[model samples]
Target chain A: MGRVVVDVMPKPEILDPQGKAVAGSLPRLGFGQFVGVRQGKRFELEVEGDVTQEHLDAAREAGVQVLSNPVIEDVVAVYADTAAVQA
Target chain B: MGRVVVDVMPKPEILDPQGKAVAGSLPRLGFGQFVGVRQGKRFELEVEGDVTQEHLDAAREAGVQVLSNPVIEDVVAVYADTAAVQA
Candidate 1:
């Protein structure tokens, strides 16, 4: 199977409460080295066969159209996971 | 500043309703080539200075200890994003 990885992150200008909660907890948990934390979403899309260009284009479209909200989030990365394609 | 990227995913055996919902929506949205979808989390942890081995180790520890719930999620990747650092 082939896999495509899509990363979606909150826009820099937008507020991220989930990330804030995590950042708030880190210091209390003894991980004070971290100055900030931004939590986002990662998606793996499985394909039946080898991932083609069409699949990548479609995945990018899906990344913006479905996986992320364009108003508050940005599709940061979209690429195929070649290591995931097994013989 | 440097950034460490941590990826967390639902364990294979764990149920992922969000992923299932996305999978179900794909075909209806004309992305039928995708056979499956799995949704997870991506966290960007900011560091005060250059990324060191100590920071990487701490990020990995935080990945498992705080970022993910070992009960149903797995920390899949923890790495530095060299491209994100600015001099």
Candidate 2:
């Protein structure tokens, strides 16, 4: 089987309340050194097959439709089976 | 400035309703090939300094206290300033 990971985040123009709250709280929490915080989502898609071109495409599509809300967020998918990822 | 990323996922024993919903919907959406979908969160912590051991430790503490609930989630923090991540 192959695994593809999709990272979904709020579009730059969108104001993430959670992110802002975290950023504001960091300094109060004694982690004032941090400049900011941006929160997002990670989806691990596990397909029951070896890596393939088709699998990649499906994963990307699934990530777009199932993992993120296009009206507010963006998504990018990566083939996790690559040696670069394992490293 | 430096950045650290914290990945937070539900512990294996915990049942993730969101993940299950996505997994079940994939097939209905014509992506029946995918076996499962496990969803989590990614937190991008941006610090106003070069990455250092102190920065890394602080990021970890913040991730544990603010980014995730220790009882249900597993978190891993990484130094994202390195080329390995940028690449």
Candidate 3:
């Protein structure tokens, strides 16, 4: 089994009202030092068979084409076993 | 600064067309053993200041209220420094 992680974010130029609202609320959330809070979405999937680059690419393409709006969003696909540890 | 990760998934009862399509592509990605690929969305936010439970709670609430469709999706909020490592 393999796992895939997809992250979707609004275009940098786009006005993320949701992000802004969340950023504004950070102070209230006890993150008093936080001045900005940008929010995005994450998706996780478990593949039933062997994991391959082609599968990852196709899955990512599908994400860009159907799961998100290219005009307003950007996506990143990460294959769990091969993904670099986050910094 | 603090980071918040929000994962958004379509409700199990709802049809996740994008996820299904992505799942279908996994075989090509080299994940032949994978039979199911449920896709979700991930969002990462970098707070400019301190991080607190209240900030986390508020951020999570905002995500649920405005960032996602409650009827069609579910969300999970994780505070980076305190988040339990995924198994």
Model 1 per-residue lDDT at B75: 92
TM-scores (chain A) of the candidates: 0.91, 0.79, 0.79
What DockQ results do all the predictions give, each relative to the true complex? 0.89, 0.71, 0.32
Off by over 4 Å in 2: A81-87, B81-87
Q: Which of the numbered candidates is closest to the native, going by highest DockQ?
A: 1
Docking class of 1: high
Could you give candidate 2's per-residue lDDT for residues A9-64 as a string of tens digits?
Answer: 88767898989998999998898888878889988777765667888887778778
In terms of lDDT, model 2 sits at 0.77
Please tell me how candidate 3 rates in CAPRI terms.
acceptable
lDDT of 1 by residue, A1-87 (tens): 999999999998899999999999999999999999999999999998888999999999999999999999999889888764443
Candidate 3, residues A1-87: lDDT per residue as tens digits? 565666677766778887787667656655454455455556565555555777677557656865569999877444454433221
Tens digits of per-residue lDDT for model 1, B1-87: 999999999998889999999999999999999989999999999999988999999999999999999999999888888766543
TM-score of 2: 0.84
lDDT tens per residue, model 2, B1-87? 567777788877789999999999899999998887778988877766567888888888888887889999978435564423221
Q: Candidate 1: which pairs clash?
A: none
TM-score of each: 0.94, 0.84, 0.56
| Reference interface contacts recovered per candidate | 0.85, 0.88, 0.56
Best by the TM-score measure: 1
Q: What's each prediction's clash count?
A: 0, 0, 36
